[model samples]
Target: MSDRKSNDEAESLLAGLMRFTGQVAGGTLEIARHTATMTAMFGEGWVRQMLLHSMEPERLEAMADAGHFLRDARETAGLSLKELADSLGLSDKSVLEEVERGDKIMPLELVLRSASLLARHDPVPFLIKFLRTYNPQLEQVLEQWGVMALPRQYERERRFVNLYRQHDALRGLSDDEHDRFIQYIDGAAQLVLDVMQKEKAANSPPTRVPKRPSPARKRTPRKRS
Candidate 1:
């Protein structure tokens, strides 16, 4: 290989290494912290990113989904990144630079606030971008670590699968027991769907309640000294 080609490859590899380490150091913020409480289900990983980062994945995928989202917000309000950044006391150029180089990482609350101020929408979508930036293995490993995610959950899942199979054991259940069995299965399914749907909706659009103005209060005239 030519020396120049070798140098270029080395540079790319180093950039990737730096980015990866940057991500790992940032992993607590990206994956472990954000994904707490519930582990992913679909065989999932930020569904949209999972596709592109998935390989042959997507420059075609959800990239436009969010940019378009942010763009509309920009146009609708006739605000430029600079204008919004100035409003927030930030350097207009830095904001654009981050967007162009795609290095924008901010806390969730700040992202939302910035999005609202800039786009008239929440900035939470940056979350998908964050998750997409991470390696999902970190989340799985962290979850499998420590007391909070004790193997007990996996064990319980295994046991539940076992019980569910036993619950289905008949050549077919007798009619009376069959109805109860169906109810059990149906109820279990509904419970799972309910949990998943709640989760999906939760992850979708954030529900923002604009701060309400405090109620009016009557003021008494000044008392004489």
Candidate 2:
């Protein structure tokens, strides 16, 4: 009888220990899954930040040269400096000006916005060009991690891949040819902007004239005296 009682107590303790171990294992798995989800969502941004913090001096200068392309593209698109700066959510136009002048490192976010707006919503070419000029090391990092490939793949699969195709056609242009091509794009966009302005003026409501104030009587001064 005593021996039976001892066996019952031993079995209960063993069961409790096994249950506790299982619960701990389950909790660990849940934590790991949550970690992975967070990493997938934010890891690239974190990596980019890290890379930006460690940029080399020569790369920084090259970035200034790369930045002129944004100015060229913006002008080609017929966008005002303020318009592009506003689209990038900058508080001051000078911030964007500095970036274009290469007085500042172009933030990754700025690059994306500039590329998208200047390239007619196709950001791949500008992104590749800018990164190659601004930070080849970062470009290599993104390529190795498959980040760069994503945009190219997206461009290839997009319904408007014609833009991408057009860019590809210009890849072999001599420097002078490229400049002429840019001039052509700029002229076309400027023509469109002019047409749009004319249409806007034609369609706008006429300005309302303000009511003129009645003239004060000359006798008012004599009355006051």
Candidate 3:
């Protein structure tokens, strides 16, 4: 009688576990499908075709390059293996090796040191580099089509991607709301572009400096990279 009871309990537990697993799997798929539908609906205008026909290779390359740059930047900071570990409150010499090689997930402290030591005064450039490198084609496409078009384009894309990913939120919105969201994307892109272009032009180096009879030789703008 005890043996039979034990078997029944085991079967009951297994059934519960299977149901739990199925729910998790089902929920994840539903999320992905919703995301696809939203993007298909709003990845319109320039990236509509590109998004539908987007390639992943360029993205992979950009990420890899950014990772390599991060590693190199750390090395260039003159941080010794032991020193970086000390900075990270780690004592293991091999730890830095693993972090640099991507063999292990670098801890937050280590990443902070990397961002601080390598990126120094500004880490934003490194990020922009990653974006530019990882999705060169997309970057190129965005640059050519919408980059100069408006900052709103960037802003709209950012928000739309987020909203579309939030399954709970996306599921709640009606079709009309989705259309308004798409329109926001278009308007935002134009607004951002117009503002950025104005800022760029106003601050740009004067095409011709007022002629000074004994003018100092015109200084060249230093390249950031």
**Structural similarity to truth (TM-score) of each candidate:** 0.28, 0.36, 0.29
Q: Point out the higher-scoring one by lDDT: 1 or 2.
A: 2
Candidate 2 stretches with Cα past 4 Å from truth are 1-57, 132-134, 138-225
Candidate 3, residues 18-78: lDDT per residue as tens digits? 7645654464355356556867777634433453244356544554555565565555565
Each prediction's RMSD over C-alphas, in Å, is 27.1, 26.7, 28.6
Candidate 1 C-alpha lDDT tens digits along 111-151? 45656575343333334433333443433433443423443
Question: Comparing 1 and 3 by TM-score, which wins?
Answer: 3
Q: Candidate 3, residue 103: CA error in Å?
A: 3.5
Estimate the lDDT of model 3.
Answer: 0.57
| Cα deviation of 108, candidate 1, in Å | 4.0
List the candidate 1 regions with Cα displacement exceeding 4 Å.
1-68, 100-109, 119-225
* Residue 212, candidate 2: alpha-carbon lDDT: 100
Whole-model lDDT, candidate 2? 0.66
**Where does the lowest 10-residue lDDT sum fall in candidate 3?**
99-108
- Sort by lDDT, best first: 2, 3, 1
